[model samples]
Target: MNIQNFSVASLLAVITLSGSPLFAKEQTQAPAYEYGMPLDIAQAVRIDEPKSTVCEVGQATMTYVDTHGQIRHVTFLQQTDACAIQ
Candidate 1:
């Protein structure tokens, strides 16, 4: 009936239809990988399920999903030299 009431009603309707919280509308995204790691790591590392992956730069371990949908873990470099392979 009034301007204040109408504003609130309009905002509620928009939020309800969107099915997401108002805070979500201006959501901030997290870093692709854990902190204290080189920026290149995020770009080079691959993960099947980014959300499920557990990246520990200090431990040099990265978890991801395989092609078969199975979870897998890999290290940056173990015995074999990755650069040599390339």
Candidate 2:
């Protein structure tokens, strides 16, 4: 039926449009910081900590400028803020 064809076309169109951004959102991933990794941060540009109310561990990210003025980001795991308040 024509209605079935239209529904299929609409579904395909919606799927195609929604799928593009998921790939674009993954532009680049930051380097994960490990224990004993030497860090010499010059100026911290921004810090994005996980936003959660649960008292659990989460991943946090920080953007900083190195001594050479190169912008970089690093990811690390830390306890959420909810744990600190308790």
Give the alpha carbon lDDT tens digit for every residue of 1-86 in model 1: 69999999999998787876655643543334444554323222453322213332222445555455554444442232333344
Q: For candidate 2, what is the total of clashing residue pairs?
A: 0
TM-score of candidate 2 against the unseen true structure: 0.65
* lDDT of candidate 2 over 1-86, digit per residue (tens): 99999999999999999999977755678889999998879999998999888889899999999999988789999899999888
Question: For candidate 1, which ten residues in a row score worst on lDDT?
Answer: 50-59
Worst 10 residues of 2 by lDDT: 22-31
Q: Note the residue pairs that clash in candidate 1.
A: none
Whole-model lDDT per candidate: 0.47, 0.90
Model 1, C-alpha of 8: deviation from truth (Å):
0.1
TM-score of each: 0.23, 0.65
